[model samples]
Target: MPHASATARTNQMRALMGGAFLPSFLGLAATRVWLQVNLFASYTQSDDGLFTVVNNLAYGLVMVIGAAIALRKPFSKGNRTTVAWLGFAVMTFSTVLILAGKETGAVDILAVASVCAGIGGALGGGMWTAAYVRLGLRQSVLYGFLSLALGSLGGLALSFLPEALSYTVSMFMPAIALLCYQRAMKTDVGPQPAPEPIYDKEPRSTMLFIFGGLAVFGLALGISRGFPAGEPVPMDALQRVVHQMGVVVISLFIIWWFIVKRKRLSFSFLWRIEIMLVAAGMLILSVFPGHFTGLAIATVNIADTLMLGVLWITLQDVARHTTTDVYAVYGFAWASRVLSRDAGRVLIMVLGAMGASSYAVTAVIGIVVFALAASMALLLSDGILKLRPLFTEDVAAPARRSAAGAARETRRAEMEGAGASTPAPAAMPSAQAQPDPQEWFRDAFDLSERETEVALLIAQGRSKSYIAEALCLSENTVRTHAKNVYTKLDVHSKQELIDLLQNRE
Candidate 1:
């Protein structure tokens, strides 16, 4: 039984890894290498940050437009697929233009490429966001973290490849991402109708708090990137590799904390960490100027990577629980981040062009850092940070029920001891009298027959081994079914399942 259980876990991990690869590959192929090495280098001749500003502006606008359209007229499955293919084609053509411009030194070609890349990338991003929404919370987090880790590794590997080879490989990333999307379409089920209320009582406030926080963070990131400190030091291949490694390390730790340890990670906790990292990085940049620039950059990258993972998870959670169009939610959230970052970058550039003194630049950094800290504090004080339902699992419900159950038991015992004529407890309801909870949940969540059986045994307090023996299935198969049941029911454990059933009764 133990061996089978281990095997089942291993297989599950493999499946998640497989699912994560395409997204990670797509990310690798789409932006990091191409943007940094090709476009940025080429455009630096005209203006160091012009390409980035244009790229980000175009990207943000596309996301906003796409989201607005989706809100007004949600795309059918056929339309979504068609749009995604179009996006893939556009992105590929953009890459070709970039290469052509690089070879021929045509600034116009690169400018057009930047716009194409941004539009194409936004379309592709929406498609991926929809795919993630279908995975729910836990699966989405796992897949998200794994994808980040894999993308980091891919980036690290590309650092070793010759520039020509790397650029060549990058051109094919959109096609690979599309292939992965197709694979997901075949293997995964469509989004099920939510049984509970989809609309929140005060969704606008919740969204403002969440997306507003992201905007501040993004602005800080942009300031850090654009800060003038003796001409920004371009990260060498070694530095790039180290940066990627740091991302990988951080991604693994988050996966362990969120998935393996199953800890409750509040958004407040995430914000606190990010604020500190950004503040520290900015302080370092201000004090040292030219020295330790890599260290400062590394801190910013780590903070951004962490924020991005949680942000994606939070977006998915909101989309799942709310009536707001999922595409709009994702699009607006992304735009908020991107556009704000662009604002910060542009702010710094304007200041630099104005011949701002070092002291003034330092002052600006301090103000941005202060704004971030102040915003985070406001969020915490407003109870917005405590909005776990928008990000983390609400395990407190089960804990509260457990405590209430104990109190009821104690009250019943006291009543009996007092010799009062308490009414006899009603007889347990039969399957005919009340629908079997396992069967009901099965129908509601669209759980398979095997999952229904597993849930029933689990609620009865049967061990996995015992259930496996009774059902004549491998422990691994039983374990898989149990997991599916838990995910479908949105419960964390067997005890929660039991509490849920009792409540239903």
Candidate 2:
């Protein structure tokens, strides 16, 4: 049994690392490397700040528009695949145009390339979100960390390549990502099928809170990126590489903390860490100005990377637990992030245009940073940012109620067995005469062995925590099985399940 469990786990990990993993890592690396090489890195040297700003604006707007379309009318799987491919093609072409424009000093050509890149990036983001929403929470977090690490490495590698070569290599990355995404969708590593979307009891409030928090983080990151004098200071090659390596180190530490130490790392914890890192970076940048600029930038970059991982995992969690259209949820979340980021950048630009003094600019940035931190604290205080656990303790009340009902049934049976004179109620039949509902439901639903065990316990009025303890499984794993059972049995709630098992009219 141990060997089999180990083998299954190994297989699951392999599946996650292979097909399910590549798209995110490759897509992120490719986008970052491309933008850094062609836009940001060359901005000061080539004096193309306008191009950089235009690209970001276009990217943010197109992403929101694409998300809106997706929310309104999600594409079929085939259509989505096709759109992803189209995006890859556009990105490739845009890369070529960027290369040509750089060689010829054609601002118009670069502008066109920027717009194309935005459209391509938006499409690719939607596709990746769809793929990520399918993974379990642990799987999402693990992959999110590892991919961010690997993606940072990939970007670092590409940053070293000659400009043309880098562009040439990056052009193929989106296509490869699309192919990997297709593979992930086709592959099934577990006995159960992909989980179905469940009805969200409070999607509106939940989404609003999640999106609002992310927007604050995004704006903070954007403002930090645009520090000093509105225009972003691009890191040189060595600084850029070192910054990415720092991200890799952070990712490794998180992986160790979560997996090796077996700690429960929550989203709220990550949120706090991000806020602290951003605050520290903003402080350094504001105080020192010219000195330690690289350090301040690196600090913010690391924070952004961590926040990105958190964002991916949080979005996936929301999608799994909510009945909101997965595409719509992803679309809205990403849109809010991108738009807020642009808004932050524009705010910085406005300050720069107003000819604000260094002190005034620093004061404004500090104010924004404080607001961001305070807003997040408010969210945490209000319990708005608290994620729903995979298995909630709310089930305990239902289990207790069901246990009392069982006890009453048992007492009634005893009275009948004792030959009591008073007649028992007609509605409450003896459970013994009923077909074993556990086995009946198990067989009818074609449940697996583990699922059968879980179902039996649930039918016996066991709370999720009790079942987890009894079965020696994590509550999250148990929830997965429970969800599978609920989905297969066509039931929505524990009480409904108990009533069905009791053969109640």
- TM-score (C-alpha) between model 1 and the true structure: 0.72
Candidate 1 lDDT, 175-195, residue by residue in tens: 777877776665544223232
Candidate 1, which ten residues in sequence have the lowest lDDT sum? Answer: 39-48
Instruction: Tell me the lDDT of candidate 2.
Output: 0.65
Q: Which residue runs of candidate 1 sit more than 4 Å off their true CA positions?
A: 1-48, 189-199, 229-232, 378-388, 392-505
Instruction: Give per-candidate clash totals.
Output: 0, 0
Best by lDDT: 1
**At residue 241, what lDDT does model 2 achieve?**
63
lDDT of 2 by residue, 114-205 (tens): 77876676666567666666665545667677777877787677767786787778777776777666776665533212343343555467
lDDT at residue 340 of model 1 (Cα atoms): 90
